[model samples]
Target: MISKWFDERLELQKFKDKFLNKAFPVHPTFLLGEVALFSFVTLVLSGIFLGLLYEPSTGKISLFGAMVPAAYASVVKIDLLPLGVIVRRIHHWSAMIMIASVIAHLARVYFTSAYRKPREINWLIGLGLLGITLGAAFTGYLLPYSQFSVTATSIAYYISKSVPWVGDWIARLLFAGEFPAHATVPRFFFLHVMVIPAVLVSLVGLHMLVLIKQKHTEPGANRKRKEARGGQRLIGIPVWPEQSYISVSLFFFLLFVVVLMATYIPLNPIETFGPPSPVTPVMRPDWYFLPIYGFLKLIPGDLSISIAGAKIGPEAIGGVFFPGILAFILVAIPFLDRASEAHNYIENPLHRPFMTSAGIAVAAFLFMTTVSGYIDVLHIAPASMAIYVVVVSAAAWVISYLLLRRYGRAVKKGEHVES
Candidate 1:
């Protein structure tokens, strides 16, 4: 009855034919984007439930017959609920999966050279989503208000203070006063539960709208262009059923995996870590942040440069400048890589030597840096750390160079034979 009523007034069939039933490219690689979107949906549902019981205040309160910070106590209370722990676990696992899938999605876009011409804005949107994901994770981590959370946050605070003249100002703004001020929890709470999520949703909607307007770029989109214009049509399933089924399947699969992990493999046990304190525990960010964390450890803590009395330290290098450069390069790819001639068709990795080599080198560096972050926690010797760093750098460069050189010759030979 509802469907008929809406269809009569709104011409629902027309809308469905025009948009809902649009064809989408079918491929395993394309599933990464769907994974990210569905995980976000799960996050929103779980976040709403958790938010109902979570007290954002950091003020002291009683928990389990002992006094604890309100934030910690609230979290404990929630955990004690029949399924609170599982829900929280699901939220955490969802965030992890979202981050991983987003990374995988971006990598697919990059390696395939899909971020070209008309798709540039979508690429920028993808970058925004990545930034927002990191923000959400950082803020959410503090809600536990455990010793590890506080300690890890302090590292973030100091990293912020590593900026130039405005470093101190930025840190002050973030904490709302000195570190662990009364306003700290509230600020993060609002951003985590409201502001950041709102922005992410807006960007995500815009990304989808843009994608639909531009249509999805597939591996051989270029080859099919002429046929498409001649009304030959493309190969794929409609979004209403076939595509929808695939998306629904991935959603359930991700949920099951996260729930299974939550049941067996535990994470972030604050019951043991206890509340915040003067002494910071061994601080480490999630795996995604490990690269930056590892890089920061390599530079001396007090290392700095004076620019007209503005102090730029090792934090500026690892936290600010390094990431800044990488982001700039990523955003500039559409313009940098044959902008005048670039097309939506994704060329094979071997056919684009420079892009392939650069991607490999960058990914290799981050992987090695993550290894370094873990190695530091084990109290490895300075000699060993140096050796590891050198070996990683050499291996990355050597492998990338060899692949490019070998592929370049093969490509040239093929072109010569064709001519």
Candidate 2:
């Protein structure tokens, strides 16, 4: 009776036909999106527990007969709470995994040419999600109020102020005065706990709606099947039971793995770093930000340009302009590789040697720059690192292109190829 009444009012059959029975491809790469989704859910749940106990302020507070920053004191209390250690670890690992899965998902989509035609908007949305995820990580890093995190974030403070005309205004707005000021923690706390999360959740919803409308991109084999059928019907398990079961199982497995990692792996022990101090520690930013850090290091410190009464410095060049260019290229990709008609089939990267080689080259540059980011700790020379970056990236492009072309030729001659 409850089902019948709901069905009558909600038009349940139409809803089922639109969503519940939609096709879901059975591919392992497709699971990366689910991993990101589940990890974000885990982050939210764990963040709630942390938020309840956290005091987001830098003002002095009595802790164990000594005064410390309220933000640091609260984190210390959280550490003493039962299961707090594990919960914090879970949150950290979930963020790490969430970022990793999103990057992997984006790479899969790129290599397969899944951003073509109608799906371009979704691609941009995915990029927006990544930017917000990084922002979340950055803000959360400062909540511990440790020396390491403060020093690292201060790098960002200067970078923000490196923008030509409005640098000072934007830096003051973002950091709420000289960073590490009384208001800085509360501002970041608001963004981390409330504003950013709201935006992220809304974007995720829009991403899903776009996905449902455009439908998931499938393997090249699916195109052959569709052509044979003389219609655009997708071939996959229905969303109602089969895909639902798979999704549920995947979520549980991911949860288990995250918990296991939390149990075994340690992260961000605030006590070691202690409270924020004027004496900066020799530390590096997280892995995701390493490329930017490296790029910053690569640029000459004396480099500066003046235009329209605005001074542009090395910090702006490396931190703002370089990253902006990369982002612009990513946003412009679908337009650059435009298709006249709706193209749903996955393209084999091996069949498109130029594009694949370009990806490999970019990956090489990023990897080498990341290595250069650790030059101070690694005791490596800057000139040597720059030489390595150029040499390795060019070599990667050449080798990958030649190998892919040879593979294409072999396939034309009826020789079987693997991977």
Candidate 3:
């Protein structure tokens, strides 16, 4: 009755037929994107709740029968509210899950060569999503306004200002007067709650629109369906009942798992960390940012280069150029690889030996840097850091070489050809 009523006035049936009956391929690897999408949705819902009780001010306020910084005090008050602790922790864990899921989904796209020609624009959009997500996380990281947050923010400020030419200007723009001051919190709060979220939400909508319009890529193994004039034939169930049920089930399952995490392991106990200060603490940044932080630490602070009377140090080397080069490489993948144009059809990684091996090598370096981030926090000796650097790098390249050799022989024998 309700459906008929709505359909009569709103013509809802046309929209339902357009999207609900759409074909959707069912594959575990393909589901990674859905995981990321649901995680972001969870983040948004929990974030709105947190924003209601959160204060962006750095001023002291009397709350819960005690005096404390406005940011910290509001958080404490929120925790006292119904399901407040669970909601806040859910937000934190949701961000972590969102980042990890996106990275894995991107890796799947890369190994399967799904980012070719028609998908290049999507690839760019995905990269933008990653940047916005990270920026949102970083800005949120500082909103706690704890001692640990202040310390990490100061280190980041120094790194920004360490660049030779425009470092100082960048740092000044980021924080108006100086580090650990009242001015910075509101700026971060604005970016975290308003600017970054707006951009991210818009991009995510556009990404979904593009995906729906272009149609999904299907596994080459499914040869039963004939190819369309411009795209591959997708053989799967309609989204109306089949795909929608699974997606909704997955969303609730994810929510359950996150709730369990929030119940068991609460994130960032603000009282223990205390308020913001100049004193450096033993704590580190969130795990996702650890690699970049570790990279900056690995370089010698004393190392410097003179450029027109300005002295730039190792921060620019490990912090600037290295990361910039890596980012450029990722963005340049479609143009650099001569065979990217042929990556339209989805195929198993075994079919692309060289590309697969090269990707593995890249993963190794990222893993090495991520572990390196924990050197100081974990109290590893400097000698061990040096040794691990050499060994991890060499081992990555060696493994890639071995994979290539084995696959090369297989290709020569005409054993496994890509569809």
Cα lDDT, all candidates? 0.84, 0.89, 0.81
Q: Return whichever of 2 and 3 wins on lDDT.
A: 2
Candidate 3 lDDT over 148-255, as tens digits, reads: 777777877887787778888888888765776788989998888888989998998999898898888777755544443344556778998999999999999999
Candidate 3, run of 10 with poorest lDDT: 223-232
- Judging by lDDT against the true structure, name the best candidate: 2
- What TM-score does candidate 1 get on C-alpha atoms? 0.93
**What local lDDT does model 1 show for residue 172?**
86
Candidate 1 least-lDDT 10 residues: 226-235
Per-residue error (Å), model 3, residue 144: 1.4
User: Which residue ranges in model 2 land beyond 4 Å of their true spot?
Assistant: 1-13, 415-419
Q: lDDT tens digits, residues 1-419, model 2?
A: 99899999999989998789999876668889889999999999999999999999888999999888988999898888888989989999999999999988888888888899989999999999999999999999999888877887888899999988999999999999977578888999999999999999999999999999889888888878878998878888999999999989989999999999999988888899988766876677878888999988888878899999998989999999988888898899899989999987778888989888888898898899999898888887887888888999999999999999998898877654453
Worst 10 residues of 2 by lDDT: 410-419
Give the lDDT of residue 292 in candidate 3. 76
323-361, model 1: which lDDT tens digit per residue?
778789888887787567546566677767677777887
Alpha-carbon TM-score of each model against the true structure: 0.93, 0.95, 0.91
Which candidate wins on TM-score?
2
* Residue pairs with backbone atoms closer than 3 Å in model 1 (clashes): none
